[model samples]
Target chain A: MLNPTITEILLSLMQVSYITLIVLVVSAICGLILGTILTIIVVKKIPVLKQITVTFSSFTRSVPIIIQLFIVFYALPPVIESMGFSTTYITATVASIVALSLYHGGYLVEVFRAAYRALDKGQHEAADSMGYTPIQKFRRITLPQTIPVALPGWGNALIHLIHDTSLVFALGVVDIMGRGQLIAASSYGMNQVKIFLIIAAIYIVLTFLSDAIIRFFEKKNKKFKLDSGLNTKGA
Target chain B: MNFLILFEDFVQLLAVVPQTLLLAITIFILSILIGTVMALIQEYNVPVLKLIVVIVKLLLRGTPLIVLIFLMYYSLPDTVTFLSGLVGLDYNGTNIPPAIILIVAVSFTVASFQAETIRGSFLSINKGQIEAAQSLGYTPYQMFKKIIAPQALVEAIPEFSSSFLIVMKAISLGFMITVVDIFAEARLIATDNSYYVEAFFAAALMYWAISAITVTLSSKYEEYLHSRM
Candidate 1:
């Protein structure tokens, strides 16, 4: 066994921590945008589209994100390569974005669907009596109400996405977990167990910080009173 | 555009259906089995076991599942090698079953989640129901078996169904640790054959079937139980 050292451990933890935050940001943004579009289509209630949205959303949620990343990283390049595009960091980033988007879209659809379903019918009827069109009613009433109702589920989605972002390590993204595993392997060879411990500590730290952000949002959004109002109904 | 090719691989991927379902069902059954027993212990406030249960639940709930899978894979072989060397079993040289490892890791994870749901369900029952069974001179086990267990299971059905789906989907992590489940196999086929659409669509179909069957089964159970009530 190699002699144990403090320096190697510190270096490894630093590298892994930075990667974790980057992956979290990338995945969360991707999930947010895709979630919005899917939420719209799902709420629009297009005849065939509703079933399509539900099916796609639920399937995405049910499948493993690690497998999703593997499929995207491995399969997407060749599919896109047919158009004479070479795979690069941008492609990889875009592919991860798509994967994260698809994964979180499943969550967003659920949030929105539940939000739309939970609103009392009287509000819509009230809007209708005022001669508001479906789109207008949605814009003025349904959409506004959905925001608060979806806030809590949306928070859960964000938390899940942050945690799920760790799976991107398997896709060769070298995210936090990827970096940790690398450092751990290297440290094992070098007899630096403290590095592995430090890296693990970093994950715990980030998770704790993330939980705080979510809890803060949840408490701050209590004014909407839509959380309980939403959880019981459509979801 | 490539629908026919995808259709063919989709059918090919169906071969993994049984394995996926088996993993899911095993984890569901075993976790619930473990979870219920643990929950019962918590209800009785069993001292040392309760502390262990709390810690297990926290770690299980706190860490991501993939991390647990990795930790288990590495830890088991090391332990097995050490044990075999000590006991002279001389059997550590053989490969351990990936499916079994995956089942154990995922089941424990499910148990952490399931125990919470079961406990919640159990506690939700009216106290009088338990006392009523006790007043009938029933022992704690008899009271739980007759009155509490059935109600908790029914109350917990929806959460359980969703958790089952999550666990079913989670088996895809096996591939990361080099266990060739359906998704893992599809990744190889897609990469080797350059049939991304075909391979992934095929896997997606299998995933859909699994999801459909679970949802249908749970709903059926829900209806049957409601009618009986």
Candidate 2:
């Protein structure tokens, strides 16, 4: 087998970026929904549901991503098949997304919880006095305050999610890392170093790019001035 | 779903717990040592060293652990050969074990994160306390031992254990480079019986247990530090 050309590597990286974008967007949305539900359960202290969410969160937090990926990849099919769904569509990419979304959701639970708890109770009471509905209170009061506080943690999680995408290649998703492995292996490992270096450079670029975007939001969050006197009395 | 197979896989995975622990602990200690030196370099503004440390840390932060492991595994031999040739010495890099390479790579990656933790804790020391210690004619060592070390250790413990958990997770990547740590052992068992799910769950359980223990211990130590103060 011949060593891959630069164009081949670039094309592979393009494919990687595409998959990464899908994973990030889908997982972020899923994670937000999961995190909100878990946060609600925990905040309300909903008996069995709270315990189950807590245990699930801990499990996601502790298990290595690779193992989690494998478990999901191998286990989801059987479960889905038993539910009368075809297991044929449960590809490596799908399993990776599921696993990563769960990990993201688990982490966001803490971020949401902390940000939610940091919110001043007076704001809720004030919203209540105004005869605001629950949705109105959440939209007008809860979100604005918690988001600024949560932005930093959320951004950190985003960066981690980007890093976690690199692991998806282990599940044979043909992402950048997987492509690099194939390129090297096809050439009898003669180009392993070069391929690995290229892969690393790609990952670094992705991480820094996301980090800069996160920082921009973080800077914009400063305008809220939520960290000032308003929230101080609550703590 | 098969409880018996899961139990058997769990036992098999547990047998390799020592290997995983040894790797995790060694990497943790080595990284801490390297990270402290890097932190000290930055803390004291040690001229050119600070720039190099910063660059290394940035690179480490950006790159994934598996990439680092692969890069080191592939490049170290050539690097060793080149250095030996330059030094007029006979050395072969192929003789080095995969475990050593994994340790070195993971240590560097973990060290970058640890350096930040150490430096943050170091900076958390109050300037007034240092000034007071100085006025008392205490030596730097005395100031560190009497005042700085305790406070910094307390501040650093929580972050350090988080890094420890990271180290634990990172060693799982060792399976890629043929290091038969717990995760690797699990994969072997799964391949043998096609019980990948059970094998992975067992591995996950061990990882979860280790993390729980680390978190509990660190929090206890933090409490002890608080009580002492």
Candidate 3:
């Protein structure tokens, strides 16, 4: 087969990356929200559900993002297709979201659980006495507090999802790594190395930026975030 | 296809079990060994290594390990094969040297995370505990060995086992590199039977089982760690 041109390959990879941003952003939001819900489930049933939640989170958490990506991108499409749904761009978007939502949601579960655990019970009771509905109390009294608290860990998951975007190459989605692979296939002497290394560098820089943002939020919530994780006192 | 025919293929595929387990176990042992040292270096703030360690921490922490597997698969064999020819150990396909390369590549990543667990466990030892050791006239090394290491190991096992579970999930990357683990075998079956669903169902169940065992082991290890304290 003829080797594709360097510029074309790079452009294709870039195009893949452009679409990937949508996946990452959507997945980030969905994962965090779903994960928060999962956290609430665990909290409501701390004796049994808590253990199950923690176990599921840590188990999924233990798997590498790459395998999860493969399971989502390659494995799921066929499964979905067998059920009669077309899974074309779902390849990129749904796959990323599924992989990430499961993984990132796991991380968020802990963060939300920790944040809720650490909130002074007096605040909840105070809101309760004022006749606030549970939903209203969560929106005003609970969620805003948890967002700042969860930001650091959630930010880490966001960066992680970005880096993981490169793994879309498994089914040839033409993301940055896919582009690097193409570039490697095309050029001579050091061009392949240059392209791949550049992609890796971009990934690193993005993560560093994420770490900074996470730290920023962490500082904002340092008092709450630190004491949140280990404070086992009931609400 | 008849049931017996598929059953035979399943049996054949099961033969790869040893390879998968062996690869996972050896690679993890090596990774933990390397990772603990890296963790210790990061903990004690070892000289100029900290900068390198930080760079590595980011690289391992951020990059999808499958990418690392690819880099190792594509990069290492020629150099390793060439070097081995001189020593005449005759290493190739049988040993699946590429798998070892993937293992090494993965170690670098796994170690970065494991280092955090180690560092956390180490730091959790508290200042007075270290002071008590120093008061007993123990050197820093002596204190770590006689006092800190025991507690840290106990504290770390639960998390470390979880890390091991993480590494096991990572082994799915091996399929990409042609290690012929269950996933790869399943793919081959999918191709032959054109039953992508069945093959994948088999594969998913296999992965879930593997995941279940891993979770069980880690939790048990956590319980064991708790007992020692």
**Candidate 2's error at B213, in angstroms?**
1.7
For model 2, how does the per-residue alpha-carbon lDDT over A1-235 read when each residue is reduced to its tens digit? 4877776766766776777678777887888788889988998899999999999999998998899889999999999999999988899989999999899999998998898888877888889999999989889888778877888788878878877888888888977787788878778888788788888888789789878987888788666646423455443
Residues A117-188, candidate 3, lDDT per residue (tens digit)?
A: 767677788889999999999897776666666676677668767766666666566667766766666554
lDDT of 1 by residue, A1-235 (tens): 1443566555655666666676678767777777777877877777787788888887787667766765676677776778787767545556676788778877788887787788877787789999999889878777677667777677767767766776776667676566666666754634323443454455555666776877787676555555334455533
Off by more than 4 A, model 3:
A1-15, A41-99, A187-192, A220-235, B1-14, B77-96
How high is the TM-score of chain A in each model? 0.79, 0.90, 0.76
Give the candidate number with the greatest lDDT: 2
Candidate 1: stretches off by over 4 Å: A1-7, A47-49, A74-89, A122-152, A184-200, A226-235, B80-95
lDDT of 2: 0.87
Q: Residue pairs in steric clash, candidate 2?
A: none
Better of 1 and 3 by TM-score: 1
What DockQ number belongs to candidate 2? Answer: 0.83
Instruction: For candidate 2, give the docking quality class from DockQ.
Output: high
Query: How big is the positional error of residue A68 in model 1, measured in Å on the Cα after superposition?
Result: 2.5
Give all candidate RMSDs, comma-separated. Answer: 4.1, 2.2, 5.0
Please give the TM-score that candidate 3 achieves against the real structure. Answer: 0.80
| Model 2: how far residue A17 lies from native, Å | 3.6
Which docking band does candidate 3 fall into? Answer: acceptable
